[model samples]
Target: MTTASDDQKLASWRAFLLTYNTIMRRMEQEMQDEQDLPLTWYDILAHLDSAHRGALRMQELAESVLLSRSGLTRLVDRMERAGLVERHPCEEDRRGTYAVITNRGEETLFQAMPGHINSINQHFLQYLDVFDAQALLRVLTKVLEGERPAEGSQAEVIEGDQ
Candidate 1:
């Protein structure tokens, strides 16, 4: 039995997914057109830059960049060829490997970051107001963490976190 609330939830879910895809596609296009950089590469490099020693273990990198291990391996290989990243053995676990960001990678990320930020702000953040942004942050955080916020936590979600 589908209630009005249930229908609304389904619509909300679809909206969230559609909006996410639209934003990502636009960002991807912007990155490629303006910076001549693939968004996936930019994402991987950005994650690595913030990681300890500008590197992450293969599995960790895959998880951080939301890629399958094999997919990440292929991309890393291409990046290595482009002198943007390199792979090295993990001393702690011989079976593990780390993907280290090269100097070129850091340089590329710095160059691309400014334009990417502008694109994000223009395409997505521009639509959100202050309290709406705050409320969204709270909601997304809860959803991502798979945990409900505390009692009265809803009250703390301001209208403008975006």
Candidate 2:
């Protein structure tokens, strides 16, 4: 009962998954070998480092990193143990907490940035020309627009439940 359009969509989805997994694996390996950093840890550090005042509320950080709130909490716990980040209780909201990048986290991110950029350039960006990059940006932006959670939707509910 599948139509031609369904077949095309399936193929595109599979292709995207394959490319994403391949590129991420290569990048992860390169990062581990060159800087002894895991991509997830690097991602967390990068997000925290880029946030205003080098911090973000736990729920916001979870959303930014595409992690479930519980997953983010566990990851933050691990990072805190490593002296990479710290949790600060929010003054305005007693129930809320912020993740703040530490000096060690900043230093680690600075160390890993070169390898990360090189991995992107070598594995991904080099495959695109300017026009292709623009087209990709447009396509991805459109896709993300649809995927983003609605205001006060399940995402918010999940954050509150956590």
Candidate 3:
């Protein structure tokens, strides 16, 4: 019962998955070599660093990271022990908590950004001209808008927006 268009779309999705995995692997390897941080940890730190007040509620962090509650809790435990982040009680809700980026985390992310950019350029951007990059960005924006809630910006995640 499948149409040719559906087959083509499936193929495109597969290709996108393969390319994304390959690029992520390369970026992860480079990040490990240059900064000794896992891609997930870096992702968390980057999100926190860019968040309003350099912090986010635990649930917001989990959603932004695309991680489960328990997974984020464990990740934050490790990060906290490493002095990269700290947890604070939410002002409005006693039972709630926020993950705040520590000075060390900020410094680490600042240091890692250049290498991350270079890896992005080497693995993906270098192959694309400006026009291609712009077009790709437009397409990606569409995809992101489909997946992201209205409140979350590409650069920062804020509460009460969605």
lDDT-wise, the better of 1 and 2 is: 1
Residue 74, model 3: lDDT of 97
Encode model 1's per-residue lDDT on 66-156: one tens digit a residue.
8999999999999999999999999999999999999999999999999999998998899999999888887776775455444334334
Would you give me the overall lDDT of model 1? 0.89
lDDT at 48 for candidate 3?
95
Instruction: Please write out the lDDT profile of model 2 over residues 41-125, one tens digit for every residue.
Output: 8999998998899999999999878899999999999999999999999999999999999999999999999889889999999
Instruction: Estimate every model's Cα lDDT from 0 to 1.
Output: 0.89, 0.88, 0.87
Q: Pick the candidate with the highest lDDT.
A: 1
Tens-place lDDT per residue, model 3, 7-111, is 998997898899899999999998999999888898999989889999999999999889999999999999999999999999899999999999999998999
Winning candidate number (TM-score): 1
Clash count, one per candidate: 10, 0, 0
TM-score against truth, every candidate: 0.88, 0.87, 0.83
